[model samples]
Target: FMMKGVTPGPLLFQEQMPLIWILFGTFLIANVLLLPTVGLLTARIAGTALRLPFNLLLPIIAAACVTGAYAINNNPLDVGIMVLMGVVALMLRRGGFPLAQVVLGMVLGPILEQHFMVSAIKSNWDPLSFFERPIALILMGACVATVILGIIAHKRRLTGGDESS
Candidate 1:
C-alpha cells in the first residue's frame, strides 16, 4: 500500500539523490505489481480463514508468532519478548483497551524521541525551537486533536452512544 525507498542509513550514503530516486522507482514498481496478490490474499484470509474458532486457531497463531520471532535472529530472547508482549496485549484487549494506540506508541515513541533529540541538538539545546517551526506546530496540533477525538469516541462507546464515529 506504500513505498519506502530510502531507509535510515548513514547521511553520507543517502546523499546520492539519483540513486535514492532510482530505488524509490524500483520500490514503487514492485509494490504496484504485488498489490493485487496482497489484496486478494488479505481478503481471502479475512473473509474465511479468520472466522475459525479461537480455541482451534489460537495455538496455531501463537506458534507462528513465536516461530517468526525466533526466525528474526535465531534468539530465544526475541521469542520470550514476543510471548510476553502477546500476553500483555491479550490482557489489554480483555480490559477494553485499544491496542492500536499502544502499538503506535511503541513503534513511534523511539522515532519521535530521536527526532526531538536531533532537533534540540541542531537548535543548541533550545527546547522552545520545537514550537517555532510551522510544520512542527501543525503536527503537534494534529496529535492533540487525534488524542481528543479518540478520548471522545471511547467515552461515547462506553456510554452506549454512537460507535461509528
Candidate 2:
C-alpha cells in the first residue's frame, strides 16, 4: 500500500498499519517456538554437564567458522581474514580493550562518517544546527541522560549492599 501510494479507507481502519502488526506477530511466534526448545536444551545440557573435548570441539568450531566464511563467497581467502579478525579480537580483549566496541565502531564507522559528511554539507557545515532540530536535541539529550543513569546504576551495583541501619 505504501509503495503503491494507496491509502486505506476509514472503514478498513488499520489496513495501512497491518504490516507492522504482521511483523510483530511473526516475531512473537518465532520467539514462542524457539524459547521453550532453547530452555529445554539448556536444562538438559546443565544436567548432563556434557563437555566436548577441546581437541574435538576446536576442529568442529573451526570447521563451522570456515564454512560460514566460505558461505559468504566460496572464497578460502575470506576464511583467512575471518580467522585473522578473530585472533585480533582475542588479542585486543587480552590487552584490556573492549573488543565488542571496536568491532561495532569498525562496522558503523564508515556509515557514520558518510552520514556526518552529508549532513554537514546539507547544513552548510554548521554542526550546531544538527542539534537545533527539536527531535535531534531530544534524542541527544535522551542518549546522554541514559548513559549517565546507566553509569550511576552500575557504580551503585559495583559498590555492593548499603548499610540498612
Candidate 3:
C-alpha cells in the first residue's frame, strides 16, 4: 500500500476518507458475492483442504511468513519478533483462548485511545459535543453497523462454523 501511496493510520482515515468508504463499499459487495462463490466451491475446497499435509505445511508457512516479514523494511529483527509472536499466539491458542478479540484489541486499542484523547482535547472534554455534527451521526451509524456485523459473524462462527445460517 505504501508503494501505491496508501499508508494506513488515523491520518489516512482523515485524508483518504473517500478511499475508506470505497473499501467499505467494496467489502460489502464482496461479502454479498462471496456467498454464492463459497456455495459452489465448498466441496472442491473442502476436498483440497482435507488433503493438505499440515505437518509439512507448517514449516513452509513459517518460511513464507519469515520471508514476508523480512520483506518489510528487510529487517531480520522484525522477522524474529514476528516468529516470537507467532509462538506466543500458538501458546495462547493451545490454552483454548480466542485469538481474534486479542488480535483486534492489540491492533485497534491504541488507535482508539488516540482518537479518544484527540476528541476530548478538541471538544474541551465535552462528551456530548461529539454528536453535534451531522457527519457524527453517519459515522456512529457506520460504527454501530460494523460492531453489529462483527458480533453476528463471531456468534455464527462460534456456533455453526461453515454450515452457519
Candidate 4:
C-alpha cells in the first residue's frame, strides 16, 4: 500500500518507514499505551462521572443507525431489514448461538460468491474443471487440511487435552 501511495491516514505517517509498517507499529504502541490508560479510566469511571443517561445515547445511536441505513439504499426497506436482522440475531443469541458465525458469514459471503462465480464462468460451467486447476486444487487441499486439523483438535479436547497446553 505504501508503494502504491495508499496509506491509511496521517496518524501512520513516518519519515523513514513505509506507511504500512508505520501504521502497524503505531497500532501496537497505541494498544500498549491504552492498557494502562483503560485501567485507570475504568477505575475512575467506576468511582464517579460515568453516569451517562440512556435518554441521550439511545437517540444518538438510533440516528446513526438510521443514517447508515439511508446511506446504503435510501430506502426504508433497508432499515426494516436491519431491524429484522437485529431481532433475529437477538433470538439466535437467546437460543445459545453466538452472533460471530452470522457476522462472519455476512462479511465473507460476497467474496466467496464472487470467486465461485468467476471459477464457474471461467470453466464454462464445468465444475470438475475447478478442481483440475492448480490454484483451485491448492485451495481445496488447504480447506480439507483445515477441517481435518479442526476435527483432530476437537477430538483431543474431548479426550481431556489441556486447553492451555
Candidate 5:
C-alpha cells in the first residue's frame, strides 16, 4: 500500500514488523468500535438531506466538490479534471452504467499496472512466471471465480426478467 516504497516511522522502530502490526491492530479495533456510531450519524444526516429538493441540493454539492478538488493542490488543472470527470460520471449515470465499477477500475488500474510491470521486470519478462507463485495462482483462481459468478448472476438476472414479464 505504500506506493513510494517508504514506510514512515521513527528510525528506532522503522523495521519492527510487530510494532507495525500492533499499530494496525489498534486502528482496526478503534474503527470497529466506532462503526456503529458513525453509521448512525451518517444515516441521520442522510435522512435529513433526503428531504431537500434536488434543485436546491445540486448546486451546494457541486460547489463543495469543486472546492474540495481545488483545495487538494490549489491547482486549476485538478479542478478542470474534476469537472470533466463529473460530467463523464453524470453521462454514465444517465446511461445506466454502474459508477462504482468505473471508480474501482480507475483506482485499481494503476496499482495493477505497477505490480504487473514490476513482476515482469523481476521475472525477466516471462509472463507465465506471474502464475508460478502459490499466492499469484490463488489470486488468479479467485479472479476467475469472481468472473464466473458475475456471468452467472447476469444470466440469471436476464432470465429472471424474462420469466417475470
Candidate 6:
C-alpha cells in the first residue's frame, strides 16, 4: 500500500471501500477455515521444531536470518548488520537482560519514528504538543507503568521477594 502511495488507514477505508470489503472477506474466510486446523496442529508443529538438536538448529536459524537480511536488498551490509545484531542479542542474553523488549523496540522504532516525524511536522515541530493528544498521553503513561513494573519485578527477583508481605 505504501509503495503504491496508498496508506492503509481511515483514508484507505474511505477511498477504497471495495478493497476493504475484499480484505475483510478474505480474512474472515481464512480465520474460519484455518483456525481450527492450525490450532490443532500448533502443538505438534511446535514440538517438532523444538525437538531439533540445538547444534544443528542454531546454524539453520542463523543462516535463515542472514539469508533473509541479504535477500531483502541484495546488500552485504544487511547480512553484516544482521550478524552484528545477533551478537548484540547474544551479549544482551548473557547480561541477563530481556530480549523481547529489545526485539520489540527494534521492530517498532522505525515505524514509530516515521509517524512521530509526521505528527511533529503537522504540529510545527513542537514535541510538547504530542502529549496534548489523549492517546499519546495514555500510551506514555502505559510505557512508564511498564518500566516501573519491570523494575519492581527485577528487584523482587534479585531480593527473592518480600516474604513478609
- Lowest-scoring 10 consecutive residues by lDDT in candidate 4? 7-16
Residues 1-165, candidate 2, lDDT per residue (tens digit)? 656765666744565467557768999999999889997888888665437677877787789889999999989899999989999988998999987799899999999999999999999999798898899999999999999999877877777744331
Tell me the TM-score of model 1: 0.59
**Relative to the true structure, how large is the alpha-carbon lDDT of every model?**
0.87, 0.84, 0.89, 0.84, 0.88, 0.91
Candidate ranking under lDDT, highest first, comes to 6, 3, 5, 1, 2, 4
The TM-score of predicted model 4 comes to 0.55
Stretches of model 4 off by over 4 angstroms after superposition:
1-55, 162-165
RMSD of each: 8.2, 7.6, 12.6, 8.7, 7.2, 6.0
Give the local distance difference test score of model 5. 0.88
Q: Candidate 2's error at 161, in angstroms?
A: 21
Clashing pairs in 3: none
- Which 10-residue span in candidate 5 carries the lowest summed lDDT? 4-13
The segments of candidate 6 whose C-alpha lies over 4 angstroms from its true place after superposition are 1-46, 134-165
Taking all chains together, each candidate's TM-score versus the true structure is 0.59, 0.55, 0.47, 0.55, 0.62, 0.60
List runs of model 2 lying over 4 Å from the truth: 1-13, 16-50, 134-165
**Leading candidate by lDDT:** 6
Query: Which residue pairs show collisions in model 2?
Result: none
- Residue range 1-165, candidate 3, lDDT tens digits: 698898877799899999889999999999899878886699788787667799977777779888999999898999989978889899999999899998999999999999999999999999899999999989999999999999988988888776636
Best by TM-score: 5
lDDT of 1 by residue, 65-133 (tens): 889999999999999999799899999999999999999999999999998889889999988888998
Positional deviation of residue 163's Cα in model 6 after best superposition, in angstroms: 14
lDDT tens digits, residues 1-165, model 6?
888777888789899888889999999999998878996699788789989999988998878888899999999999989889989999999999999999999899999999989998999999899899899899999999999999989988888898554
